[model samples]
Target: MTLHGRAADAREASHLAIPVGSPILAGAHRWSDDEGVIEYGEWCLPPRMTIGYEYQP
Candidate 1:
């Protein structure tokens, strides 16, 4: 077991990748071509989102 220890265990199993998330939507989505609909929408959090997949260990 040597080739630089199997390339350092394949770069530590492809580098310690973790901690990443996104889902606080709604930052832009305004439309009003002469008042046709939706205007000034914004959300910092709370829209309901939960499917699954949040850890690699």
Candidate 2:
């Protein structure tokens, strides 16, 4: 069994995501300081990732 962690919106705000190919999004996940231990079944992203800025060019 795998169990992930979830923080509040305010607390999760600290969590940043690693930039895939953009410098602006570089090291974004470093902002989160209240990160709790997470256990993911598959560390890889899902087939369809949540592209918040998929349209950005």
Winner by TM-score: 1
Q: Looking at model 2, which ten-residue stretch has the lowest summed lDDT?
A: 22-31
RMSD in angstroms between candidate 2 and the native structure over all alpha carbons = 15.4
TM-score computed on alpha carbons, candidate 1: 0.24
- Report residue 19 deviation for candidate 2 (angstroms): 25
User: What's every prediction's RMSD, in angstroms?
Assistant: 18.4, 15.4
Error of model 2, residue 50, in angstroms: 3.7
Name the runs in model 1 displaced over 4 angstroms.
1-23, 34-38, 46-57
Where is model 1 poorest over a 10-residue stretch in terms of lDDT?
1-10
lDDT of 1 by residue, 1-57 (tens): 011111122333333231223223223456667758756553333225333357877
What are the per-residue Cα lDDT tens digits for candidate 2 across 1-57?
232333323222333343333222111122223585443232223222443445556
